[model samples]
Target: MPRAYEEIADERQHGRDTHVRRPRARVVRDSGRHQWEKDRARRPPAVRAATGATERDTGLLPDDLVFSARYRTIEAPGELAEAFGVCEGTALLERSYRTRYAAETAPFSLVTSYLPHALAAANPDLLDVSREPWPGGTHHQLSTVGIEIDRVEERVSARPPTPQETRELELPAGTAVILVRKTSYDTRGRIVDVSDVVLPGDRTELFFTTRLERW
Candidate 1:
């Protein structure tokens, strides 16, 4: 009986030792860094590229103004002012026009603006109209022209086109209008001019080209 009791006590001790030596369950607290890393990894690479540097570093070009006069006669002076969002009486000078072959069948129109003709002409370098690299924005271009741009006022309106405008300008379906008004000032603190631009969104593709030079 004594030997049996001793053997039973030794068995119980071995069982207790085995339980103590077994691995405990570990609880890892979440810190949220793993989830954040996962979310960042899922975003598009272009978003990361654009956010990584300034315009100069990324070699992006300035905005190009694209105009189409396919269906209209020469735009009137007042109409030009209305289109550009400038004040009334701002003169509209026809800078240049060319008939270019887009594809074999579709021949599109091209029009360029000498913006300084309406406003006061600054120095040559200030009004350089060549295809040089520039930042992509209207305000940025106006800044290069020596015009003190205050703010951009946008107005969108749609109306049935007049018989003449519709026939000449070639109105299409869903042909509403977009007007961007740019208010600028001169060195004398006087409101120099306001420019408004009208665009037919379907046919016009504004091309902005920028080339970055080596440091």
Candidate 2:
């Protein structure tokens, strides 16, 4: 059966809105670095375009920002305890960072990281938030204590942002957020660190590539 005219119009408007404003085009690829490579000269890929007359600015996050991180000790939550194979009340270092953009009202992604206190206690600097954006990111931090991250697994999910997330992210109504739970393991097959990251869906893209063994 032919679609109703009103429903067709609504669908068309939604398509146009995404194409013209929020393209979600950034290819969020992993370069195998715990931190992004400093490539200030790289321009973000272009947004989906219409004719030259209709092309508009891309919805990209700011390139400059104020960085802040808070660190504290807490008992491991049950799920984390199970994943780390530690006692239910094992102490863990909880670190959270809050970023304020130079040009935008909304903040960027939210991330919370957890590490076993026993492991990090070996390096006093790991407990200090002041040392962050810490020279080489997580993998480097772990190295200072003889822990080498051998592999990482990330699980991605999405759902509408919570009321608090909407306000903090300054998201427009009906927008969603992407959630990534990343687990890092050392050569011993022990889960060494875990991070939960929340990304705003309006401006982010997820990408991955795989190589195959020679047949």
Candidate 3:
């Protein structure tokens, strides 16, 4: 649910203030399939322009990606706990996102990222959604705290979205959704963050590049 609606529902359930405002959803659009492709070795000049590149580094120069993030802190869920290698009672900072293209109202994808409180405690800003779009993205943010992400593991799968997902992503009947679960690991092999991304099957694509060693 949108954060605003969730707040309103909570208030109503407790017979509290009924004047709660509903939060608006943010949409992000993709220019082409370029953003989905993995090409770190051949990054465009824009990426090199900054010591730390953000959404703008993806070749959307002049036009930046627009989005909103709803954040919360909660006990780590079972699956999240396993991914983080922590006990179930650990606290986690969750940032839920909806991104849209310039001037567009519908979202291109839905994303949620979870950060272990223990690891993220160094930077108070990471716990707050209001601080997001994080200038240089998570990499720069983590670097500030002496943690370097050396490996990123992305697992992709496709399946039918739930009814709620269907409504949120505005998918049509029989449409499948592409799910990408990305886990970031530090040099010490500690999981720093895990992000779940949902892409509209009709408008999303993925690409990979590999170089084989000659024997």
Candidate 4:
């Protein structure tokens, strides 16, 4: 469900008050092989750009390649534990993905994705890093195990890059990093995926479109 519609608002004017209905964003059901293919084709642009050096960047990410991909079972950390609503030390899968331009010394971005170990373990291919950048991304990976992502929420923040980040991104002086935490939910409103993305702020932009209801 969209958080935007979770709370209703009252419109008051000319000493009169009225309630405005806030309908949640609509979701269409996906079916059959084509939908699956379409969804797989929807892999993050970043991944698409990373796959081939000849491909032009779609403005979302740089033309790069997956620097490395690996996974391990871990006791969910504080943030992951809370985000997944699991016990403090519940087991989960941590999939780390780093990208860099083949012709550049600095990294393009850092992405760390997480999923419930038990849920993901249902599909062995998901645990193999060699299968990355998995076609359709996490969505396809989840679908292989019957998970259908219904929505995603992103929270962005900024701060000075950590020494490690500065070194990894090879950022210049006075450059800060933007952190985007993305949470994905399934059809049952379960938090199926969570990821943290770090980007060199100098080359990133965020745009949001607010849809207004026609009363």
Which candidate achieves the best TM-score against the true structure?
A: 2
For residues 105-189, write the lDDT of model 2, one tens digit per residue.
4556778999999999999999888886564467667877998777788999999999988888777778899998988899899
Ten contiguous residues minimizing lDDT sum, candidate 4: 24-33
Ranking of all candidate structures by their TM-score, best first: 2, 3, 4, 1
Task: Give per-candidate clash totals.
Answer: 13, 0, 7, 0
Q: Per-residue lDDT for 210 in model 3?
A: 54
For model 4 the TM-score comes to 0.72
Rate residue 82 of model 1 by lDDT. 55
Which ranges of candidate 3 are over 4 A from the true structure? 1-64
What stretches of model 1 exceed 4 Å from their correct place?
A: 1-120, 136-138, 145-147, 161-174, 180-182, 185-189, 199-215
TM of each candidate vs. truth? 0.33, 0.73, 0.72, 0.72
Q: Candidate 2 at residue 135, lDDT?
A: 46
Report clash pairs, candidate 3: 27-99, 27-100, 28-99, 28-100, 28-101, 29-100, 29-101
Provide the lowest-lDDT 10-residue window in model 1.
21-30
For model 4, the stretches where C-alpha displacement exceeds 4 angstroms are 1-38, 41-66
Query: Relative to the unseen true structure, what is the C-alpha lDDT of residue 147 in candidate 4, on a scale of 0 to 100?
Result: 84
Q: What lDDT is reached at residue 82 by model 4?
A: 94
List ranges where model 2 is wrong by over 4 Å: 1-63
Q: Relative to the unseen true structure, what is the Cα RMSD of model 3?
A: 10.3
